[model samples]
Target chain A: MLKKRIIPCLDVKNGRVVKGTNFVDIRDAGDPVDLAKHYDKAGADELVFLDITASHEKRDTMIEVVRQTARDVYIPFTVGGGIKSIDDMRAILRAGADKVSINTPAILNKELITKGAEIFGSQCIVVAIDAKAKGDGSYEAYINGGRVNTGIDVFSWAKEVEKLGAGEILLTSMDRDGTKDGYDLELTRQVSELVGIPVIASGGVGSLEHLYEGLVKGKASAALAASIFHYGTYSVAEAKRFLIDKGVKVRW
Target chain B: MIGIIDYGRGNMSSVEAALKKSGYKFVNTDDIGILATCDGYILPGVGAFKDGMEDLAKRGLDAFLKEVAKTDKPVLGICLGMQLLFDYGEEHGGAKGLGLIKGQVKKLTTSFKIPHMGWNSLELKRESSLLSGIVSGDDFYFVHSFKVVPDDDSVVVATCEYGEEIVAVVECGKIFGAQFHPEKSSDKGLKIINNFGKLVERC
Candidate 1:
């Protein structure tokens, strides 16, 4: 009985966490390591630090954050955003990140997925896809943090990455992001069904029921949320309890 | 002291952090002399079985580990490291293991998923020191595409159900192995690490 994962994603910039709404107990909410420790204590199955740093000069800050988090936090965590090359992936993983999530770079150079999986193993490479529903019962892969549309079909991209030896897929629905509506269940289910690897449903989870829907209805192996846990709307423990009561197996 | 064998595997920092948090003194080394000095050794790895075995062999750790298996010093293997304790593995074509235990590793043929990647509950089969203070149904983080099939059933300490009966923990004499990453399983995982640490002290 493999438990469905509950991952709390934190956006990091210049070594500090960004877009974090509230955490009264935490002395430094901006500190990515502190917030990561808080999530680990709160029983997050895993954590994801999306390094949104815009400058290459400050990118090394995320590595420091990963180093501190790995020393302090016990649960597995993934590092994404701004990761472009093999050296970038090696730096993060060597700093103790369990997995490295790549999106735009994977789209720009499909060889990154193949070479990364070959060098670091497939389990270490996670191909994150930001998908936007095209209103025609289809979704297109979006990159550059959802600003640039790759024009690649989401289903075709998902299959391609799997063939390229990706261990997991972090599928985010652009249309549903920040809407608090819910995950695009159709997008999640279609991709999860299209690939043999695990698919993590991300973007637009407003309630515990949405988490349930993402896992049960969306057929996702894991559900990733940010504001729901950060805004204090629902703790990871509470969501796990809700999902467990709803018959979803989650790590306690 | 526990020696964490480092042979260019995926990550050793997580294992080092867990051992430190568990209040144990350890050394990360591939040198057999240094590993021989430690009371117990932890073979921690994350990757393909063929590659992992090759890394161990490159550092002459495969023969050393086999010799350690004959002693009373407790040795624990995690994930791909656990798979290396078997006699053979069917990953990346096929590869020979250290033969520490009587078993063969095979790709998980479960209809559910390929990498069975997530936390899962353990079903205890028998008692062992490695599982001290841990009980049945306790969850551990697992990430792998294969499972070990022990030739002797008595070596299996616990099993987890993942579309089938998957071996989770195994113990034979002083050698133990877990398919899951105890270092990343949080509190309960720390308990297992502490148990192995205490076992080393007693040894």
Candidate 2:
């Protein structure tokens, strides 16, 4: 069976990770390259970089970060945030990113998904959705890191993105993000069951059991977490062992 | 030098970077003449099989690859490049492939999911120069919706199960292919690229 993936997302601002890591394993744990190397060694299936710094001037620095990370870390890492145009996607990809995740631009101009898939192939385009539960048994898609509401239905939007040529969907639940409670299983399962493509469950991953829930209960293809792994709450190898111990197949 | 064929698809730079990182000299070019001179050829691609095949034919690379196959001097394909090594593919309408390996690329009919993306463990079926020094069940990165089913299972170097067995690596004579992107698969994956480099060196 296809192994479930555990990806550690690094939030970057101005070519540097926004938060510093206090890991004893990594010499410079806060450094994106060093942190990525640590995760690679820890058995992370993949890594994702979100460019919180969307400034045009900072683009070069972001590219440099990607290049350096690519040189040091061999596992594929995705670059998200601030990627607006195909040229941006091409630049980062050339700089050595295996895939590019589009959230804001994909919602603003849905054609970007189809066009990007047409030009670079669907495998390279990952559509990320930040959704917050409506309390009315529905969820609304958000952009700008769950700040702005797009008023789009999450289920319908996921299907649209899949139809628009997106190879995978990164579904983040704003309701559970940073809460450390667990994934929004209802939302993840709801959206995942609707899309034919793979869905990566993100936000509020606080424990190994939570990741398993994201997979077994939420029906996510992969589970993505941030702080827990970043701050050394648990190593990726530990997460894999935990998952496999519970019958979830994970690549070690 | 290993010749990396530019079929107007696939991340040529990633493969180039992987080659450079592994301390191998390679030329990324589409010129059939240049490709023929190299000791080995890598058909790298990323796109629908129909478009890739059409582009290869348009650029006269189809004939070039066939000619190189006859020489049997280590020809390898990565991901979509690997799928294109077969007889035909059923993506975005059925399309003909290079026929270097007898098979058809069809959509993965697993109830699990499509695009079978991310990391998966290799279940080695047999030994091959491409997977040299790699253990039987090492992990490698994979991102694809369609998989190649070789007519002759003997060519299957390894298999990765995703609801069903997926052809992970294939080798027959000097021709080779990997459904996973070895370039993006980290150390073991790069070791596979290094193995190919050794194959080129042997050639």
User: lDDT of each model, Cα atoms only?
Assistant: 0.90, 0.86
TM-score of 1: 0.97
DockQ of each model against the real complex?
Answer: 0.87, 0.70
Q: What is residue B124's positional error in candidate 1, in angstroms? A: 0.1
- Which TM-score value belongs to model 2? 0.94
lDDT of candidate 1 over A1-252, digit per residue (tens): 889999998877677666532211222236788889999899999998887654355677788889999999999999998889999999999999999999999999999999999889898999999999899999999888777888999999999999998999999998887778999999999999999999999988899999999999999999999888886899899999999898898988
TM-score of chain A considered alone, across all candidate predictions = 0.94, 0.94
Winner by lDDT:
1
Could you give the CAPRI-style class of model 2?
medium
- Candidate 2 lDDT over residue span B35-118, tens digit each: 778999888888899999998998899998898889859988999899999999998779899999998999998887777887
Best by DockQ: 1
Q: Which stretches of candidate 2 lie over 4 Å from their true place?
A: A19-29, A55-57
Candidate 1 deviant stretches above 4 angstroms:
A20-29, A54-57
